[model samples]
Target: MSASVGGAVYAALAYLAWGLFPLYFKQIAQVPALEVILHRTLWSMVFVMAVLLVLRRWAWLGEVLRQPRLLARFGLSALLLSCNWLVYVWAVQQGQVLDASLGYFINPLVNVALGYLVLKERPRRLQWLAVGLAAVGVLWLALQTGHIPWVALVLALSFGFYGLMRKMASLGALEGLALETLLLAPLAAVALGLMSWQGRGALAQGEPGTIAWLLFAGPLTAIPLLLFAAGARRIQMTTLGLLQYISPSLQFMLGVWLYHEPMSGSRLAGFAFIWAALAVYSLDGLWQSRLRG
Candidate 1:
């Protein structure tokens, strides 16, 4: 019980940090989303290296380098993560945090589908119903708005795949993230250097505060993720699922209340359907968990 409580606290903190991510990204919105991703990649590598050094965790690198297959697998996961980051940062910068939030809200359903397809895990009946409802909501949004919610779709799909890849990875959360950032950092460094040399980089054009904020992206990115890893280890999946909503919920509120993104009734209604689907999914998962125990 104590462990569970501790996990809940860690998960809540992680979600709170994630929910507040828009506030951080918006501060650096002056930087192009791609550049933001690059800096994030580079700084994350630096931060994780520092962490590993402090923890005396260098042995894993030697073993990882001996496995070419592992490297290639992580390479794909890195690409997916970078794609997810790019779309999210772009959405936030483009004043579409609500759309980004919607993507995350839809992500669990995507995970359900992926599990059924890739892992042959049979979802409960309510899970299938939840997926159908989410699909209908997505379709309604696309039809009524006369534009598919691509922002949300990309975020959900990319992240769902990223999660799937991570689920198969042999490393722990911190180590997996460390490997990903390490693999991507060289390219990210080259790109940032080229951008700076071309006089278009954040370092070249931004104010002192902006440069600092950009640097802070490393720890900002890593910390909540570490908290999440810690929390997941100690809690029930049901508790973790409930906690995961906090981030997107915060993003949605920030978009609607703080940033004042236009929320038409049509969009609101679409969200309503997705929310209902989530309700059904969550309740079913919780009930199943209790029954199994």
Candidate 2:
């Protein structure tokens, strides 16, 4: 019970940090999203590598590098992860935090479908219903807006695929993230160097405050993941699934109340459907877990 409480605290803090990510990204909104992502990749690599070195966690990395197959797999996961980060940062910069929030709200359902399609794992009847309801919510929003919610869809799908890849990965969260950053770091370094040479980079041209914020991306990207890894090991899957909603919930509130994004009656109705879907999904999972125990 004590372990569970501690895990809940860790998970909550992790989600809170993720929820507050928009505020951090907003501070660096002046930087091009691509450049921001490049810095994120580079700084994240440096920070995570430092941690791995301190922990003497170099063996798996060497073993992974030896296997061409593992490298290829991690390379693909890295690509997906990078794309997800780029899209998310772009969305926040575009004042589409609401859309980004919706994407995460839809993500668990996407994960359910991926499990069914990719892993041949069947979702229960209530889970299918939950997915169907989320689809309706998305469709309603798209129809009301008279445009595809491309931002939300891209965020959901990219992250869903990234999660699927990681689920199949052999490495722990820290190690896998380290490998992904290492794979992308070289290209990210080149991009940053070119931007600096052109005198167009935030690092070289921006205010000292801005530079500090950009550097903060290192811990901002990593600490929550570390917290999440710790919490996931200690908690039940059902508990973790419920905690996962906290980030998007905070984002949604920030978008609506803080950022004053448009939340029309139609939009609210659409979100209601998605929220209901999540309730059903969570409840069903709890029920199943209770049955197993």
Candidate 3:
């Protein structure tokens, strides 16, 4: 197969896996989200370390270790990643998967706004209009729901900042993730130890099957990421931008259909506005890409 086709397949598969993550997390729904996050961090570190070891990618680590500023920056990125994970998992476990999905749906626009505000990359007027529509959608959702959609907002913002940091990162995706997890491992270890000492640990109180699923989280987390990185390397930006909606779209369907989350007309209308914004933003991007070409 051609490179772009292969890349599209890889990217779609990655997004498909990510879209179905609610199923995976639901299997361990009995476990506390924080505990799940801890296990995820520990095992992700383990998994990535093994991958690096196999690839003999230790040189980067030594260079990274010498740079205190890099370490500090990654430390902050690690915090944002963990926060994103915690909020997302918590939302899923709490039956707020729709909110979680909406967060991701909003994430692209978040990236654009962040680019404009933080990176000083000027977005076109259409991009600004897209952001405005999303804001209005969010506001309408708040009015209808009687509260802010904090879960969606937190997930979007945390992940947007994390993506920003990664854009500035010196390492590749696997190595960056490895470093982020390395920074997080100690906290995970300490927290798990405390939980074990308090007799509240998953090993102590959870089922064997549940513990097994937790262990599987490592591969599950890393595989899609690897696929995405591989796909991204071979694909055009416009293709990647358009394909990015797959995960959230799947999540939204699963939320409303499988999980039976309430989808009121007002809620649907808010989502309509968001979708319209994305349509405008994506079409504009496509036009720009064509013009540049």
Candidate 4:
């Protein structure tokens, strides 16, 4: 029981850190999103490699490197992850954090659909209902806004596919992320080098504060994920599922209250439908867990 409580706290902290990511990204808003992503990829590789070195976690990495098929799979996952990161940074910089939060809010539903389609896992009736409700909510938002929420959809789909790839990955979270960053670091370093040569790199010409924030990206990208991995290993899946909402909920609040993003009645209504769907999904998950227990 004590371990469970500790796990819950760890998970909460992880989600809270993720929720507050907009603030971090906002600090680097002056930097180009792609450049920021490049720096992130580069620094995160450095930090995670240090972690693996300290822990002597090299055996599994060698095994994975021996398998070309595994390397190719992680390479694709890395691309999807980078795409997700780029979109998220762009969204935050564009003052569309609310839309970004909406993407995460709809992510579980996307996961459900992905499971059904890709993994051939059948969701229960309540899960299907939840997915339908979310779709309707997304549709309503598109109709009311006179356009689709492409930012939200792209973030959702990219991250959803990233998650799918990770689910099939053999490495643990730390190792998987390390390998992904390793795959991406070369291209990222080249991009940064090109930017520097052209006198456009933030690290080369930006303010000291900006350079510090960019450097902080290493731990900023890695710590929460490590915390999440620790928590996930110790907690029940149902608890983890419910806790996942904390990040998006905080992001939504930050968007509306802190950032003062416009929240129209139509937008609120659309969010209301999504919130209702989440309620159904959460309740059903809890109920099913109780039955299984």
The model with the greater TM-score, 1 or 3, is 1
Better of 2 and 4 by lDDT: 4
Task: Estimate candidate 1's alpha-carbon lDDT, on a 0 to 1 scale.
Answer: 0.84
Error of 4 at 184 (Å): 0.6
- Model 3 stretches with alpha carbons more than 4 Å out: 1-14, 226-243, 289-293
Considering summed lDDT, which 10 consecutive residues are worst modelled in model 1? 235-244
Model 1 stretches astray by more than 4 angstroms = 1-12, 229-243, 289-293
Over the stretch 1-293, how does candidate 2's per-residue lDDT look in tens digits?
68888988987898899888999898999999998999888999999999998999998877888999988998998898788889999999999999999888777767777777887877789878887888899899999999998988888888777767766677887898899889999999998998888888887799999999988898888788667666755664435546767888999999989899999999999999989888888889789979978
- For candidate 3, the per-residue lDDT at 32 reads 92
Q: Report the lDDT tens digits of candidate 4 across residue range 97-211.
A: 9999988887776777777788777778887787788888899998999988998898878877776676666778799889999999999999899888988889679999999
Which window of ten consecutive residues has the lowest lDDT sum in model 3?
233-242
* Candidate 3 residue-wise lDDT at 278: 79
C-alpha displacement of 189 in model 3, angstroms?
1.6
Q: Over all chains combined, what TM-score does candidate 4 have?
A: 0.90
- C-alpha TM-scores of all predictions: 0.91, 0.90, 0.89, 0.90
lDDT of 1 by residue, 58-177 (tens): 989999989999999999989998999999999999999998998888776677777778867777788788878878888888898798889989988887777677666788878988
CA lDDT for candidate 2? 0.84
**Residue pairs with backbone overlap in model 1:** none
Q: What is the lDDT of residue 145 in candidate 4?
A: 90
